[model samples]
Target: MQAAPTPVLLSSTPIDLSPWLSALDSVSAAIGDIPALLSLAVEAGRTWPQPGGGRTVVLWELLASVSAIDVAAARVLEPHLDAVAILSQSAQAFPDIRPGAEGAGDEAWGVFAAEAPGTRLEARSAGTGTVISGTKPWCSLAGSLDSAVITANTDDGGRAAFAVSLRHPGVTCEQPEWIARGLREIPSGSVHFEHVPAVPLGGTGWYHSRPGFAWGGMGVAACWLGGAVGVARDFRTGLSAGAEGGREPDQVSLAALGEVDRTLTAVLQYLARVAARMDDGTLGSGAGQSTWSEAQRVRGTVAAAVERVLTLVGSNRGPGPLAFDERYAKRMADLALYVRQHHGARDDAQLGRLALKGDCPW
Candidate 1:
């Protein structure tokens, strides 16, 4: 396969991700193979750099590269990497809560922190430790992954993070009838826990109130950007093929490609800048107003750019690729659904509220 485009440089000492990229490319063909993805996640957990540990850019570039290969694979990989980072941070913040060898083991981990209305996961004190019960919504690959870094409502009515093994007898992963066309391979459903043993990671509200939370959200945006890059790659290849076939592209098609190029360029530059700030500690280390506003801005920017690229590619390429080219079609569909994680207007409104409260850089 052709070499992937070089990731945007965020540090003077560039990271050599070619090996990891090759591994990801090899697994792209087996898009839905949970075992292969889990194995890769376990390997990555041992080698991938933690966010804000001076190689934040490397972490995001790795995520983006995976998405560029296969969105579903990235969907399975990103959270595992994020879970490792979370565990690393939690271990440092509360040495007493260190996950010991389990955190650094061969197990594949996931972050199941999404909440649903009327559903709750509660953590209660049991003996000298803690246990969690109730159902957690939007838990992707819950049955396949070995463990997860979960958040639950604590006895004090505040949310806290914990590490729990999914192998526990009290855990039941419900298989839902997932009918989504995009990301069909990655099934996201609810998981029910009944007094499953859990190890607390941080104090109440530390999970959401940590700076890594914002960083992790932006890392997902990087995946969205990478999915768009895959679509853009298809668009470029289609134009070239047409030219080679004596059907020279018209001005409209070239114009659409130009628009895609500019949009992706701007977003890449933004991510690089943000990653640099995160590394240098200019963005602050807490989940305060500034960091929260910046996260919203980065996610909003990348999401908008992904949307624009999707529109340009779909409208310009027409239905040919969508109907005939499987990879291109999958990339387009996956990106459309993945970018929706940004929450569009609601996120914009949140950013607006932060700005009104003097949280924005401007």
Candidate 2:
């Protein structure tokens, strides 16, 4: 008789990573799924920032990996995390960033938005030296931010970005009034800088011209993918609980959940492939208009996937706050707001604009 074939087994299990740190301690001594593995890197980046490697892809990968985690983590980790590694890593990730004049300070990059009705940050330059002012709405690493990348009307009457130190007596982080849904873990508060001394990272128009200006968006697609996994986990948990309670996971619910899972999975593949291309130098133009267009499409897909999950889970408020079934509500709220950074408005508009130009490959 032929020896019994090894049973093919599959589990829809989620691993609690807090317990396992090394590859040796990984669950079942097996490589965890990409989502879980990615999450570790993301959280690690947040809790243990590598300050010196600022210009390396590793720095941005860390940031982008955990970019979607709420602001709360940003605050908690600010004190404990290895900040020096983060800066050093960022410098390496984007080697183009320059050290300021001896007295001039550096600024932290945050993603609230552009073309918004706000002036949380401002910067002015005279020759090589620059003075920055105003408040930043959502400075990601604000508490520990060396400074804030500020924009303001110059004396000559032109808009500009200036690197302003947060330690300066002129700058202050205010209460974050509108706590958006998703990335609440970050210290996304407003900051006001008054006559803060600063230095231009590049020439008068360097910051805007940086390749990362658009690269940031594409990298963040991974975060959305993470959120999608979170949603999937939540969905599965809900279904299991409902099943245990003898409630059948209706067809509509299963279908909705599945769709969200499939769509998000597709985009996740897209992000990973494109990211690899970027690493390999296959995908040219990090911050070109085309990059923006593709990012928008991915963002829209993520948004839709989240919304589909929300709908499948139902909207009727259940007993107490915890009892309500808002499947991915918290995450969705965060993603809805975050996705706009790709310049995405509606589901259709994601690839709509791109269609006008031409079809895209995968």
Candidate 3:
């Protein structure tokens, strides 16, 4: 058999992740506090890393931080980091696309561009600018974020991306529509835009077509992996504390821990490989193929790892943590909610189809 083509790397260098890791550590204690989470997010934005930083560095740091912090806090903060990641790349990829002060942020930002059925944001030309009108659903941190990168349907039947201030006129953020008892800090719901003025960032289709878009998808996986880590750590701590009391840790607990460690170790290696490929601009870039597939694979793997960790932790520890441990209960709730971002069988089917088409030739 002919050897498969080796993926090429545009650059090779280890990413320095100390700065972002330290920043996240400084705020780790406050992660469970909703108000503090939002505040620290903005504070991080104010000192967001400059250009010339490698992609892996940003992604690794984000993953490490999210792993150490609460999942609810990760939900609130990850999108903001995603916003910066998106706009930062856009600013580099497209010279005309420059972020305003708010987008540059002394405050929080979100990418409110999920175009699900029944919800729409229409973009219309207004004088020299554009105005957006309609309801945008699943807008996380809608009321709290200072600004957002909104995707709206244009007159040409194509979608375009814009940077809009959340506090601007004609924008109405509604009460959170979440019924789940988790990720309460992220008040995601509908936001109505009635002629809300917006500045165009990139032309039609630029948002989805950019390689950085797929790169940002990996960032989401980083957060998922982090949540899994958080779950694993909670179980490990409990196991350790139990053992410290003089009795041997149960075999069931040990087996669960072993499985968790193995799964997480595999995930960590996968993440590192993807990060390196991402840093070199190869993992998710192609001429005609969808870049999103790479990130989707990572997301799928991490989601599975998270599920495994949750199951093992619950089965091994039973209801002790759930009934008495506040932090553990919260972590479980938050992670359960967050990992649902994966579309289950549907996503798997899509990935299978992609594989069949040779988009993934491993």
In terms of lDDT, the best-performing candidate is: 1
lDDT of 1 by residue, 1-362 (tens): 76644443333233466546666665565576878988888888888888899878888888887888788888988899899989889988998887775674888899999999978999999999899999999999899989999999998989999999999999999997899889888889999999999998999989998899999999999899888888888899899999999999999999999999988988888898899999898985444447778899999999999989999989998988899988888888888888888999999999998878777665
lDDT of 2 by residue, 196-254 (tens): 77644444454444444445454454444454455455667677788999997888767
Q: What value does the lDDT take at residue 13 in candidate 2?
A: 16
lDDT (Cα) of model 2: 0.46
RMSD (Å) of each candidate, 1 decimal: 2.2, 9.0, 7.2
Ranking by TM-score: 1, 3, 2
Of 1 and 3, the candidate ranking higher by TM-score: 1
Best by TM-score: 1
RMSD of 2: 9.0
lDDT of 3 by residue, 164-237 (tens): 88998788999975787777667689999999888787889988887767776767777777777878887887
- Pairs clashing in candidate 1? none
Whole-model lDDT, candidate 1? 0.86
Where model 1 places Cα greater than 4 Å from the true spot, the runs are: 1-15, 102-104, 284-289
Query: For each candidate, what is the lDDT?
Result: 0.86, 0.46, 0.74
TM-score for each of the candidates: 0.95, 0.63, 0.89
Any runs in candidate 3 off by more than 4 Å, and if so which? 1-17, 46-58, 101-103, 285-290
Q: For every model in order, what is the number of clashing pairs? A: 0, 42, 0
For candidate 3, the per-residue lDDT at 338 reads: 83
